[model samples]
Target: MIEELQDVPAGVVGTRVSGRVTADDFRDFKPAMDRMLDAGEVRIIEVIGPDYEGFGPGGLLADVKQGFSTLTHMRAFKRTAVVTDKEWIGHTLHALAWMIPGEVALFGMDELDAAKQWAAG
Candidate 1:
């Protein structure tokens, strides 16, 4: 399940993902992203919470497609803060940071407040 985070800083979008993620989960969250995209450059934060059980079904594929789309217009993203305790996710973002336009940062779940602060800046 994905739920929008309302406590984030102004102009910084935030979403929290939990449970078994599916392609359908993206459906629920897509509108927020679309709005952000329409607003031009963005500061975003994504939290993969403790209840997250990883992707299921076409989730991975859906994520790749969306990620590719985002990368193609990477200039629109001023900063991206990924909040998750998962080591692999942090490593993957770290390795890909060079290829990503703007700043891509990883933060532990415990640092969500910090993530929001950074992203908002």
Candidate 2:
């Protein structure tokens, strides 16, 4: 599941992902992101909880579709902060950051506050 995080700085979108992420979750998530992007360039903070069980098949497809749709607007993002304790998730984000137009940082779950601060900047 995915739920929006409140009380973030302006122009920043925050979300927490846990349990099994489904297409339904993305359906709920995309609008919030679009709203942020529509306003102007934005930063993102994603917190992956220990209960996160990865994405469902439909969620994967939704993610791919979102990726293609946002490919041209990648520069609209200023920063992305991923908070996760999983080493593999951190490595994956690090590798993917090379292709992203903005700065992407990975922080341990314990550093969620730091991640939020960096993303809000």
Candidate 3:
């Protein structure tokens, strides 16, 4: 499941994901993303908690479609912050940083506040 992170700045979009992610989660996620797109909020920050498993295959395909559809929005962002307590997630983000259009950063649970600060800046 994913819940919107409240109290963030106007241009920053944030969410926390947990448990076994399903296709339903992606369906729920898109509305928030579409709202941001409609508002022209280009920057984004996604925080996936420790309980996050992995995306379902269909969920993954939906994400790829979202990425392509929002390529311009993604390119407008100066940074992408992925907050996780998982070590592999950090390593994976580091490895895939180059593939992202903007700067992609990973932060541990302890550094979440810093991650938000960096992403919001």
All candidates' lDDT scores?
Answer: 0.85, 0.84, 0.77
RMSD values for the candidates in order, in angstroms, are 1.7, 1.2, 1.8
- Model 2 poorest 10 in a row by lDDT: 92-101
lDDT of 2 by residue, 42-81 (tens): 7988889888889885988987787787876877889998
TM-scores for the candidates = 0.88, 0.92, 0.86
Encode model 1's per-residue lDDT on 27-116: one tens digit a residue.
777888888888888888989877888898888988887787776567788998999998877888888888767788899978988999
For TM-score, the strongest prediction is: 2
Give the distance in Å from residue 66's predicted Cα in candidate 3 to where it truly belongs.
1.3
- Total backbone collisions for each predicted model: 0, 0, 0
Error of 3 at 31 (Å): 1.9
- Per-residue error for 64 in candidate 1, Å, reads 1.7
Residue 46 lDDT in candidate 3 = 82
The TM-score that candidate 2 achieves is 0.92
Model 3's C-alpha root-mean-square deviation from the true structure amounts to: 1.8
